[model samples]
Target chain A: MADYYFKTRDLKVGYHGRALLENIRIDLEKGEILTLVGPNGAGKSTILKSITRQLEILGGRVAVGGKKLTELTYQELSRKMAVVLTDRVRPELMTGHDIVAAGRYPYTGRLGILSREDERKVEEAMELVNAGGLGKCLFTSLSDGQKQRLLLARAICQEPEILVLDEPTSFLDIRYKLELLDILRRMAKRQGITVVMSLHEIDLAGKISDKVLPVKAGCIYDYGTPEEILREDFIRELYGMDRGSFDPVFGSIELPRPGGEPETMVISACGRGIPVYRRLQKEGTPFIAGILYENDIDYQLARHLASRVIREKPFQEISVKVYEEAREAAFSCKKVYYTEIPWGTANARLRKLLEEVKGEAGIECTGLQEQLC
Target chain B: MTEYSFHYENVRRRGRYAFVFTVMILALLLMAVININTGPVKISLKEIAGILFAGQTDGTEYDIIWQIRMPRILMAAILGGALSLSGFLLQVFFHNPIAGPFILGISSGAKMVVALTMIFSLGSVGSMSSLAMIGAAFAGSLLSVGFVLLVSRRLHNMSALLVAGIMISYICSAVTEFVITFAEDSDIVNLHGWSQGSFSGMSFGNVRVCGVIIALAFLAAFLMSKPIGAYQLGEAYARSMGVNIRVFRVVLILLSSIFSACVTAFAGPISFVGIAVPQIVRLTLHTSRPLIVIPASFLGGAVFCMLSDLIARMAFAPLELSISTVTSVLGAPVVIWMLVHHCINS
Candidate 1:
């Protein structure tokens, strides 16, 4: 019974009268950002288009601001909501300013000439998106990232209660993607503009969205806070990832671990083993990584790239059982590589294990040769 | 700082628009004067001015100026403006620069229907009323536009749509030619000249009817400029801006059809004015904002048609060329250039 700024209940959406996705439910409060993340062709865009009324809804109810979606006229809906779509708009002889100014359609007079206030809004929107310098440039001449920023500016200037975007960062590079998400976050928090957008970048989605909707084939899979929905197993299942793993803590992805028996044992801690793990992964050498605390930063990546990762509990002294396990694994490998570890109470047993392994025939220590000081 | 620049850009754009409008109006007036003054019977500028402004209806020069030359000039200007506006609308509708009534076969369709009505009515009705001719032309225009829409639904490629339009034009022209060849000699004499396209022998009554139709359609198009501007961004964006796209599209087609049908009814499918004039106007104004482009296109079309009519009248001197022949020579090159330019840029 809570009053949601935007809500869709049991909605069915698709082309013609048939529903591609049904039984969909969504609830969003004012200023909240909701993101849809799914594999390609999972009907994310269809859900967006349906809510925007670009595609007809086959069943159920959609409401905005306590009004049924079907009851609001197009002009009313336009004033309440705006959208940034994936369609490539190549308007001839239009500058970036002109393109952004089109967002004032509902506010303009019959001839669509901008009033002084509307022009100011357009300018402010462009400034917000860092597109002020691009105002006079021909829209067709802009780079994909610049064009996307301008498009976002256009939607922002509409001053709607709800803003919808479908894959707004598809063509942007890393920097622009971060910049755009930052702008969206600012707009939602400062302006109280509700945002509903689909994103292909799950990492960005988890970082920026207040709520997350994971859509699967023909239905809404689940909806919750990003912390609840962005778990490693859920993301792996949502994307049907077979050859990789998702790290929920860092929102990082790692390719599948190498196959076969361990050829080398790498002993490192405090973020030193990541590069060795990656190189061995690239060379397709099956290796075991070990004596790492379970909570070490390197263990996160090591779990996905090493054939086996031997570990001890965080802040605990290495037990005899664990040390025995590490020693056995190290001796079984053809080669042993160890990095200098700061001697500590918890991992004092590792120093002994490494010294014993150094006496063996095939062992190497990095950073030992650079210790002139 | 950007606010000041935005204002400055707006002022500069307005100034450019003013300059273009002034030039188009001046050219239109000059063309009208040349069309009135230069013919086999050379009426001096002073005499032509007197004849036009002094209300002198007593002499042979007055008769020539008032009766033969005046109506032809007015028809050329009015129908030319209408044709160009029609082309601009079609371009907006199809999102293709090359889309126009003549190129899309709507004009040929109108020409075919008018010719059939002329032949059939020559025996029974003796002569067709201007209203009847426009009605027939409108019907033909809708038919061709309908077929184009159907084909466009299946073929999303620009070149393929144009090919379909050209094929429709060929079919209509073939039908008209077949109908013309079997007609009586007197009907052939009237149909042949009209089918070739000319501004000759236009009555003041034809001028009055077409003037009213074009003026009304022009007003309707002007009022719809806001939605048309939104539409230029593409359909989904336009709809998001609250334009009722289904209704807007239908009204656009209906208005464009009315304008082109009025032109074809009076002037018989004058070629290239529709496609060439809007493109020229957009290039000159350096904006396709529709609020300015619509009126500018109308004026550009009027000037272009008046110039083409002038050449048709005096180029051979008494062995006058068809208006279509002159327009084709001038307008076809613009089209070719547009295609080449589009290719290079894309």
Candidate 2:
């Protein structure tokens, strides 16, 4: 028998005849906090939902507590497992208590009425998530952090032996994110429940999770301790975020590529966004831009080197859709410089576009003296 | 903070609010009685007491008070509670406040079948109401709720589901319009009266059928507090908490449809009570907990409908009025008041 409390063997999950994830294998045991890390749309959530029986498994079997997932009813599953999804609505009318009571659905009788023990479980769950103060607060009134905790309390009230969460820290501030991850880690340890969560924050996931499941390229790539897989290359490829090179520091899975505050970002366009991209290639800078009309030599150059662009005719009259795209690109940069032959004679609307978003992106028009003709 | 302390606080808070809700229910019952007794005849305290206790009845006035008005008044109260409570449940199930019984086409679905029976039923007077109710209930429930549930499975957002539900209602209306012209001239009168909706035709017999449905539907909704409350957080979380979401949603829509069918079968699709009343209750009570909102809505709906029914009958005098037109007149301003009040409070 496998020592793992839950295991997936070569799991492939799909819905509506479309495959979401394929060929994945991993296992987790009690008293473990396993964090799943990947960018959005990477099938991390699909994997979690599959295990929770929220979605059907297309070709693989998920076994929890040594039983096939398909075998358990929702009530039966609730006895051994619980899950929290990132999609949340703060219904304006419900106090935190009412929200928590819902977590007892599995235990309640056919009418789904609450008993004293169910109420006790609800209280216990709220206590576990540190959302006790918000019990009286209307869900709509609670702040992002408080609502997140309230949702966690609602899940804990179910009192399952295993809990799964999808992006529990997605929109949270840094302080709250850390606080939430800390709470999750403590729950797994204190209660000996298995905790599986998907996190965009690899740094947090590394620090907290007992086992880190890094999903990528339609499969769970690695599942082990954080010290075994939080490599610099691993994080970069998982999110397509690149700011550092892989440096083997403490051990096999450790890469301590130094951090000294976010470097000042500068974007170039007319290939203006491109050369600056190359210029800062040696140093880590975050910038994204894309194709300008071929008439714009700088934009052509940018078109060559840019990672991707919202490219279009450079000087044509803008439609609402095109204008919106251009507006988004202009505002995406921290500071933009129109560094080509700074032709001050750009079209009137184009100049206005530059001005309107100048405050937003902190654009400084350079090379203005460069002749237009 | 640790998880233990958090749940402790939420549970305590729920207890406090439950107590407050119980008080509100009592207050609603008192208001219901007051509204039930007040009317155009303006029988003073002594005369009203004599009519009830001393049995000093003259034929004409006795018929007006006992036979004509009381049944209508009670119908308003019962149907009001039933429709509004059903609206609250449907709105929660779809997570759309605007997703009322009529908007989903359930009421009209019942109407179409009732119209069919009124036009061409095999039997005459004695069999018509029961046959129409069976046909209305089957037609109203199957299509409206089934479509809502089916479409909801495809679309995730509450607003999106509401849009689908509304569209279904329009399609049903078009079909019902096609069917209306086929009825005989006498059946047309009955169809028209039923479609406009009235408690005026209701007697002790009509009340029995409608009242039992209201009671049974309220009981179903009351038993659903746990699942209904789960919907507040959202479907995703509800699933994670081990709720059989498909089953919960189906049952809620079924119960709401039955309530909608009942109202339409007997009283016609008496507008606004279902849609507007729940929203008003939410505004006044300041909470959306279905446990609180559901029962409160039942009482508030009853009281408002009773009061509105009184105005419909006597406001124009001699010319009997359609209850639906009265509710519309009464409903529109209440909706406006709620929106404006909400803005002010916020």
Candidate 3:
């Protein structure tokens, strides 16, 4: 209990005193980034709001730095925790500088005026987020990406030991999303700021979070390192996603493979077959992809988008049974498209299968074209 | 290099605030002089100065300047500042630019109770004390504010909130009118004048009472500028910044109610100044940092009301228009302009 910088014990959180999620537990060392990933409206924000004391905790306890959360005055808590909320802040007539300077609320004097040192800190935070030029811009006029950056800068300047953000990347584009996560990562690792935030982008969450908590169905489904919690089966069940597949290794999502038997056979190696598989998937062509090593990058995607995948063990010669299976599948298809392959010894058997299928009646074989024509 | 730019921006902002305060103070002083000078009896500025500063009081000009015009001008300035500050607080509380004492029906609510007290007290006791009238008005303001809060909880739309406020204003005004219609003929004369809103018939005593209440409330509000600034970001952020929101909200309601109630108790329900002055101040200052906006709004409100009172008195000289008529004429356009400008921007 004392080892963790922030911990929640048997916490129940919800709205209006009704528990939406119960028996939740969280523990983090100083500077550890804990991300909450869940299906929409699965009580991720409820837990966050509870921890921040924005919403009252329905039951149990939250402690920070060994002090009970309920025991800390808002002033004491404010110095230790700052939040960037999902709520849109439309402060009239305030500049980006004014907005960021608000982060010094706890430290400022009676009137909240920024001193020279406070101004320097504001500027430094802005520069840290690459928002130095935005200081003069009106907050309402900035693009969503710019606004998100300024808000992050606002949180950064607060100098909190624990920073809580609710979907900080919701409004940002990919570029800003990556930039924001990178800043959060750097802040957590270098400055040792503990981060607790909910993210819609689970892939990005997995990359940046030290620990990922999957919240679902009124409780924490699992809480562990991203490597432990973000498995394909768990992610699928966590989101109740039946139509598509999530790739844990590459963090890629693929739509459900097209229905029906194979109409085309794709022969490829390495990563050459990815685009072909995607194109075929888009066209609703249930294709067979094969004669590749299990360790190949294409194999990862083929398993998702291909109707059937024929494969060889990594670093092993293509077995006779596998080649027979590939030839049979190729003959069954009307067209066989083979990408340009560097035929090493292990995959030399694939070249023989391609030759046999060439010039066969009703079995058309062609080199993969850019257009997939 | 970044530090240099930030320093420059900071200095520039300070300079802008200083320039605006200087301009508003000049306008306030100029308007006060003009309001005193341009009343029915043609008191010259030289005589006015002598009567006001040099204590040369022996003539009718002295009576008009000291007794009639001085109290009226002071009432306009004090109540104007109070009303504007009330509106500024409401705007911050609601996170809506259009929210104000008059628009939210808070002033009308205060007016209803004050009107009821006036008629009943006139028939029973004789005259109402300034404190009693303020107390009645404050109760009424809170009642109306409570209703508005209820409506706001159910309907989160900005237009719906405005509609609810307008409906509340209509209901309160109707009740006040119903009470006024049954009053004695003599009471009607007094009630009619006040119900329409005016700065006339003010005494130094009224001025002192209102001045003290407003000054104390203004000081309290100024002291709260730090939390108010935090709140401008929104409730969640404000709370995270260590503002005890429930307590802060109650205080905001109480202070704003005290302000509008004081105005309604004295000058009836002066429209438009509450909503318009703060908006104009924010635009002129180009920032809503409450520390700056609170004082500036107070001063701006003072200037706005003084100018409006001057117009009300001198517009058709000797016929004296109601203050609300002039303020609405001047202020409604500013509100419209703000709405249009806000729409285009957002």
Task: Give the top-scoring candidate (DockQ).
Answer: 1
Worst 10-residue lDDT window, candidate 1 chain B: B118-127
Docking quality level of the chain pair in candidate 2: acceptable
Evaluated at residue B123, the lDDT of candidate 1 is 54
Question: Model 3, which residues run further than 4 Å from truth?
Answer: A369-373, B1-6, B121-126
Which of candidates 1 and 3 is the stronger one according to DockQ?
1
Docking class of 3: medium
Candidate 2: tens digits of C-alpha lDDT, residues A212-234? 88887555575878877877666
In candidate 2, which residue ranges exceed 4 Å CA deviation?
A: A107-129, A219-222, A234-243, A246-373, B1-61, B122-127, B147-171, B174-178, B336-346
Q: List the residue pairs that clash in candidate 3.
A: none
Can you tell me the CAPRI class of model 1?
medium
In order, what is each prediction's RMSD in angstroms? 1.8, 14.5, 1.9
Model 2, residue B104: what's the lDDT? 70
TM-score-better candidate, 1 vs 3: 1
- Flag the better candidate by TM-score, 1 or 2: 1
Model 1 gets an lDDT of 0.90
